[model samples]
Target: MDCLFCKIAEKEIPSDLIHEDEFVVAFKDINPQAPVHFLIVPKIHIKSLDQISKEDNALISHIFNLIPKLANELGIENGYRVVNNCGPDGGQTVDHIHFHVLGKREMLWPPG
Candidate 1:
């Protein structure tokens, strides 16, 4: 219940929401790593991708289905990077299931 993304999704905390529906919300990252950086999060408080169950498959697909449209809306049609850090070792600072949409610059692989 004390989750940041959950608060944002519930409108308890203000975010620059670019997209939203009954199940998910998209908004700019507070600390951007690129010129175009935003986060796509589920309205339901999902701790991490590994925590997703078969029952959540539809929701997950729905989230992925919206990515391309969101990228275009953010003007990243040329290309973009979608990242989901899973755990502490994976550099996940936020304990929530979310995807980072980064663009506007060429991203290098094996990310330093």
Candidate 2:
């Protein structure tokens, strides 16, 4: 697969890894929008939020379950933003499913 996040998860590409497990991986975002900007992605490719199936329930839950711990570890316990862009109209740049975890700054309303 030519997916960038997949390459990173498989260690085929270098990334500043923050956390990893059998199910998911977290890493620093190269083009950061905030002081603390990272990405959380599933090891298995799911395309986008619109593609998620019932079979992905456990994996999705696992990802959410790790967010708080990851935020605390990264020192953004006070506040953070988790964003999942679904498609072109939704601002999704990568085909692989991923969530942007942003913090260390005030996230204004009416986000673009």
Candidate 3:
């Protein structure tokens, strides 16, 4: 597949990977918004949040279950933000689904 995250997950392209397991792949964000910014992407290609099926329940659950540990490991134990943009209006740039984890700074309300 031509998806960038797919390439990264497949090791077809290199990223500053922080974590990887059978269900997901994570790496530092290329354009970080905070001192600690990274992404968690599912290895399986899901076009967007709108596309997830009931069959994806376990995968989604696993992603949520893994986030805190990763956030702590990334040194954001004090606090962190997890964002998943669903569509164009929501600021989703890439087609593949991903969750942004960012912290080490005071997060503002009404995040733009």
Which residue segments of model 1 deviate by more than 4 Å? Answer: none
- Residue 40, candidate 2: alpha-carbon lDDT: 95
Q: How big is the positional error of residue 10 in model 1, measured in Å on the Cα after superposition? A: 0.5
Estimate the lDDT of model 3.
0.94
Q: What is the lDDT of candidate 2?
A: 0.94
Q: Candidate 3 on 1-112: residue-level lDDT in tens?
A: 7899999999999999999999999999999999999999999999999999999999999999999999887778688899999999999999999999999999999896
Ranking by lDDT: 2, 3, 1
Kindly report which residue pairs in candidate 1 clash with one another.
Answer: none
lDDT of 2 at 28: 96
Give model 1's clash tally.
0
Q: Please give each candidate's TM-score.
A: 0.96, 0.97, 0.96
Candidate 3 — which pairs collide? none
Ten-residue region with minimum lDDT total, candidate 2: 69-78
List candidate 2 segments past 4 Å from native: none
